[model samples]
Target: MKKIKLLKIFLPNSLEETYSKILNNPFKIGAPNGFEPIKISESYACAKFIEEVISKELIIDPFGNTEEVTSKRYIINEFTISRIRNDHILILENPSRSVRELIRKLSEILGTRFYASAIQIDIHALSEFLSNNRDSIHLKNTRALLSGVNLDKGSSATIEITSLKDAIHDARYHFKGKTFKIERARFTASSGTKKSTIEVRSTGLISVHGPDEKSLVELINMFIAEGLS
Candidate 1:
């Protein structure tokens, strides 16, 4: 299934500030054919359009010779800013420098800060997803298993399990009403770092395990950065 992840753009102030800057001030940006302003409201501001840009691709001939070809491509994207409680969330496809650039322009115009970051999934959502798909995660669970499923404080420990799948014959426990945290994840060099088992449900619930902490943070960034694949 196609994964859908809404990237996070941190605004310097709350949603109310956005209203005074753009929504309240009311201004247009870019050419009429590019970055068109769609709508603004008391609740949210939405803008979306297709953008065409030049891109390059590699071609392999039957003789095993390789060549680079350049062409034009269109990018479809949407951006919405709204107040979810107290936080101002920038909903957009991430790692797209174009989008970030647009935000940068807006920042310069409004004198605010908008930062593109990789920390998308919050701790609670990840904790819930891991609770259910403990066996299906991408992290090195063998270490956690070998380290033992249960432990008390005040002791140094190191445990190892061959693999999460291999632990099918292992034990099960009832961990209801408990809180879990995701701190680290990694794949062995032998296994490589490519991960493909993540599923983003239709409801927009995404649960993706990672090869490492940095990889997980760059999940959405890599999605578009390597979109040619």
Candidate 2:
């Protein structure tokens, strides 16, 4: 699964100047490659994905290099930062721990400190959406893992759905006489006769396992407007 990170960049008031700085200076290093910006429409001015080459000091080569000496090794931290015609939210493709430096560089280029956070989607709302739109979306979420504080005891529990896929759309599994609210779920969605699947996690990572561009866009829009805080 491809893990993408979403960031809400706080740009300086001079939006035009910020773009000019990014277009010219571009916190990017090395030669141009596939991450280069392309024109989509007039809604967006410029978009560029960055691949950073960083070198780390290796105490000893783990790949059979002689342990007698330390050397500098290079690695590529790749991620695409697309404005996507949306200034409020910045999409980071395949984010990793090293991506924090990329975010810092961007904030420096913008001359402002932008905060980063995982785009946490409300689990309950998402399940509600899927359950209501059953005509276009056919999916199932089993083994809902719930974690919360009740009274004075904090607990996490996992429950299973014993019914068929068609009957598991209730959002929460009922056991005995209590309904357990699901706090985390993996939604696998595909339209009628389509083989591709779109996966949305409650942890705020939106990954598309298929080539459903239309659905991806729709989901992103919904996420941008309602997902991030």
Candidate 3:
């Protein structure tokens, strides 16, 4: 009979329960280097059991935003099965900035109760594919498809004045350049200061940011309502 030394298994679910069950079996022994030596059948069983356990608990939301949740689940499973592999490494990839922060916070939260194995977050590697193809046609096409309507060439103008009174006046009805139907414009006072800013952008297409959120929102709404006029 050929001796199978190492077994690789991919489990979509919980690894903790699987590891515990494997450890309790009589035939397996914990090696000094951290891996547990087991018969091939037992190793296969552990992997299968992990998959079944995970399938039951995992759920996909309607929005299809489960990447973060799935990555963490895999990490947890790997940590629980650390002793099963001689050198266990859990490599997580392509997590968002917020997700990365959450993982660190979770590690700290679970620090005392259950020790997690060495976890490596490889963000750079995951994004490496995008880095190499920065100028690809596919990327350009994709961006164009998702971008809002082009409002750059439409009738628009910007005037900078020293006084807020002048700025608001110009934004309202002073300039008669193109008369592309004034959508909306807003003026906002600078916080903790005397200066202010104004912006007016067209509706469902472009947005102009000013000194405050209120100005931005109002301008956007106005652009939508008046742009059609």
Q: Which run of 10 residues does model 2 get worst, by summed lDDT?
A: 32-41
lDDT of 2 by residue, 1-229 (tens): 4555555666564445555665665433454321344333333334554554445453546676744443342333343333434455556555555666566756666666655565666655765665575567666554344443132245535543333352235433334334454445555566766634444555555665655545654565454655543
lDDT winner, 1 or 3: 1
Worst 10 residues of 1 by lDDT: 182-191
For model 1, state the Cα shift of residue 138 in Å.
24
Q: Write the per-residue lDDT of candidate 1 for residues 1-229, one digit (tens) a residue.
A: 2223454456676554654455433333323224545777776677654455667889999999999999866555666665444444555533244554455555764565666544333323332344344344333233222222334454433333244541212212233332333232212211244553343322223334445434443443333223212
Candidate 3, residue 200: the lDDT equals: 25
lDDT of 3 by residue, 1-229 (tens): 1101111223333345444434553222222112232323332232211111122345568997554332212211111122334232222212222223323332332343333232221212212222243332111000011112233575334333333333323432443333323333333334444333333222222222334444433333332223223
Candidate 1, residue 27: Cα displacement in angstroms equals 14
Better of 1 and 2 by lDDT: 2
Better of 2 and 3 by TM-score: 2
Sort by lDDT, best first. Answer: 2, 1, 3
Cα lDDT, model 3, residue 74? 24
